[model samples]
Target: MTFKELKHFLGEINVKVDDLYAEKLFNECDTSHSKTLEGSEIEEFYKRLTYRNEIEVIYSKYASSKGKMSVEDLGNFLRMEQREDVGLNEAVALIQKYELDEAAKEKKLMSRDGFLMYLQSSDGLVLNPTHTLVYQDMSQPLNHYFISSSHNTYLMEDQLKGPSSTEAYVRALTKGCRCVELDCWDGPNGDPVIYHGYTLTSKILFKDVIRTVKEYAFKNSEYPVVLSLETHCSMDQQKVMAHHMKTILGSMLLTAPLGGKMPTHFPSPEQLKGKILVKGKKLQSREHSMTSPESLQGEEEESVSEEDEAADLPEEKGMPKKSKLKLARELSDLVVFCKSVHFPGFETARETQAFYEMSSFGESKAFKLAQESANRFVIHNTRQLSRTYPRGTRTDSSNYNPVDLWNAGCQIVALNFQTSDKSMDLNQGKFQQNGFSGYILKPRFMRDGQTQFNPTSIMQGEWLTPKKLHVMIISGQQLPKVNKNKNNSIVDPLVRIEISGVPRDVCSAETEHIEDNGFNPSWNKNFQFDICVPELALVRFVVEDHDTASRNDFVAQYTLPFMSLQNGYRHVPLLTKEGNPIASSSIFVHIMVVDQ
Candidate 1:
């Protein structure tokens, strides 16, 4: 195309151009070229066209360089255009086209900004940002098990029904439960109402229960509740109930487990929407029925051929058969499926060995499998097994612990607790010390008069409290020398102690004067002295403004308990007013005297 035509096309595409250059070219062309131009005029017109074409090529290369340009970059270019009257809508459309091209290069159909941009571009697409799509795997094992007593009050006898179900839920919430289990059965009118039994007398409207709970949560923002719905009825009934819950509550529905004899609650993958979780039964290894004589003979013959092949190998190549068996056992268990697979604890002859052996499979393998399958691996371990395999140990020779399962590929650790008290503390000291976050306390031994194996109580006190001390002592070496600057010498040395303790009043600080004016300049003012005495123990006090030359020093004293052993111990606020101790900050001085 000619230079003028090309410039017009560029303007239509929202490409900015210099106004002065366009004006100069247009003026020259209008003056020289007639309707039918001669050879020299035509040649000049072609030269101008060539120059404009070169500029267009360079501009196009810069704009489409990476197959995509940021909206900010495009916006900046548009804003700097000589054409001040360009339409904003046209500019945005052009920018979006470029962004789409970039998204294509990244193999993503939509860029992170694409959704927001699209929403702003048009109001037709009703995109709900709050609602998230969650897929359910029917074949996967349940990582978490929830039990709800919502219908227990109605089902049980009048004598048995003591506290209301709502009160029980509040108690559970206070004890720090992330998941609550509820059983739902088919009520009259095909509506799935929540109940623990098959009878109608036990049933309570699931909609009513959910509405009440949701209202409670709205009033209390801190409370986070995830419902684990157990479908006691048929798959079709469960599906109908799920639909009703979704219609009523919308996105507040957390996760529901599809349960039945031959379970099939979620119809298609699409219908299995929302945070739907499937609980698979734990599979146990069972003994195979004995084969006929002929079948046994065939198996023996195949084994013999394998042994013959092994015998032909060189001595160096052939390792011990036992070692080979061990290696095979380890590798076989490490086999991970790309799709969801119900993983019960290893139940082979090498079950114990497999538990320890499988630990070698690093986090990368575990994470890769989890991502590839798009399913979380639920690891089931009893309290006994967890205690055996304590966390942080390598699989080679380390014992099994609940934390170890977590450290391994297991995304969820399921532990069975049998205790009246809900507070469960695993007492993994190192975990508490290192601050590695994990789920509920596994099982542990509780001692009344003697140690006993029981379902450990979840109601336990804080395991550990971090003690932080920041004692700002005046540098003995920084003391003013006789020959050094004397104007900045220490005067009226003041020390302030700040201590944080549990219960706030557990620890107090009291300062005592060990020896007033004990240090002499003649003995070298820079020399460090042991100012701390037994009476001053546990008190972190800072010394300031010591006037060594005048032999006049003020020692502010405070004493605190040697140790504070309470849950949630922290740095307590030190009561200080203008660098001096207040009466509230004072603790009685108890000088422990010892004969020298």
Candidate 2:
């Protein structure tokens, strides 16, 4: 493709690039300093953008007219791609172990459906066979689970200058993110728009976002979705957002309680299936009905204290008093499930009579609460939902660790999904085990009436284990081709097992690197790690290409919850840079949970 065409293509995918950056990219691709990329250079460019290896797998899968591959054919494909000759016996055994097809065991033929299922499972990436509706107790209240949530779900990239698109909402929802944030402001044509305020992030229409949510909210899982609205629009513009939501979401929107009487307890996920709940500030009168007169007085006193604090600030001293923004009653009524509120201290919050009331706190404030008055915060989260978001300084759209907050029974631990960092890894690890339904039932000890569990107390005398994790790095199949110089193009692949969590920093072990192989390479080497806190531990398997002169490049990786990890022989699916599963690419392993 021409340089101009390449720029246009990038634009179509919402990748904004200026002329100078485009020229630099073109020069890099054209390694010979040629005007355009050609041959190997062109192929390299396409491989970085798209799944070239995955497409090759699909090609090999359908190479035969029968839409199936024999054991020999499968082995040949693996060897050809990974540049390692895999034996037919081992290939047939894998097919049998994965239960690729009941007929495959007898006929030795792997069907297309079986191949697709293997890819979707991420080569045993999922802990269980099925990955939906995994709650042990469906009757448990909604607040009794650690919910998968996203912060600033509209921005596709960084906090500042990122392109805001409805695609972000779809991506988050499809990944079982139960809670999504929408920062709404007045836009052209009087319609509400979603974007990060006082930033260079592009705008996307609010109505378009609602439509995307309506289509994808319940597509992956039939659980309720909490739409956390950060409204900064005028009352008139807020009504437009309300109208757009009601019109677009239709019957899926939950605008009132299930019954006429107020909920004595929060509803369960089972009860709110296929529902979209708006979460924002409700009208004062509606809030007044829930709180007693004494509680209301206490809230007023707290508000006065906040105003006094704000008055002391130099910025506030010279600023004019802005008029109070009023929330439209129609929009306010939609906040039936999670009504967002400013968190008062734990003392005042305990006595409040509000039902289904929710509050959000910055990461720093949440940490302070968990540290100074951990028990009070614990008691508050038991009955009511709480959301924790990243602090304002995370300009790169980074995320905080949600595990510590989950230990405190905070239901909505929102993280920046745009940045696929350690925080997102933890979010994926926690949710991937429980069917990816966006809700995992909190531990019994963390429930509303239960006071036995304290996150601060890690030295529980009752439960102790010094078990060790023994893993056999068996082999890799159909590994992706390395995009590098032909002289050193063949990667020396190795498997690294990382045990991440508590007592100290992350502990890891690696296998000996196999030379001149990206495919069916074997180590058969044993590595072990002593488990200090099994309940809080996570295991991640990473396949990296060993380099002599430069940094080792990542090939594929999978992280899983240690408690739910399957024992014995298993296949781990590899993921691409885009976080999508690489078809027909996996690492074989043998795992054993043993005593220290």
Predictions: Cα RMSD each: 30.4, 10.9
Q: Give the TM-score comparing model 2 with the true structure, all chains together.
A: 0.73
The CA lDDT at 187 in model 2 is 96
Residues 350-468, model 2: lDDT tens digits? 78847577878888888888766666677788888888888877778878877677767788999988777656766787788667888888756567564644556555532245678
- Per-residue lDDT tens digits of candidate 1, residues 355-427? 2111212233333433342112222222111111112122111222232233222422222111111112221
Best TM-score among the predictions, by candidate number:
2
lDDT of each: 0.29, 0.72
Specify the poorest-scoring 10-residue window by lDDT in model 2: 301-310
Clashes of each: 27, 1
Off by over 4 Å in 1: 1-167, 198-202, 216-225, 254-344, 347-596
Model 2 stretches astray by more than 4 angstroms: 1-126, 130-135, 288-324, 353-355, 370-376, 461-467, 482-487, 501-506, 532-535, 548-550
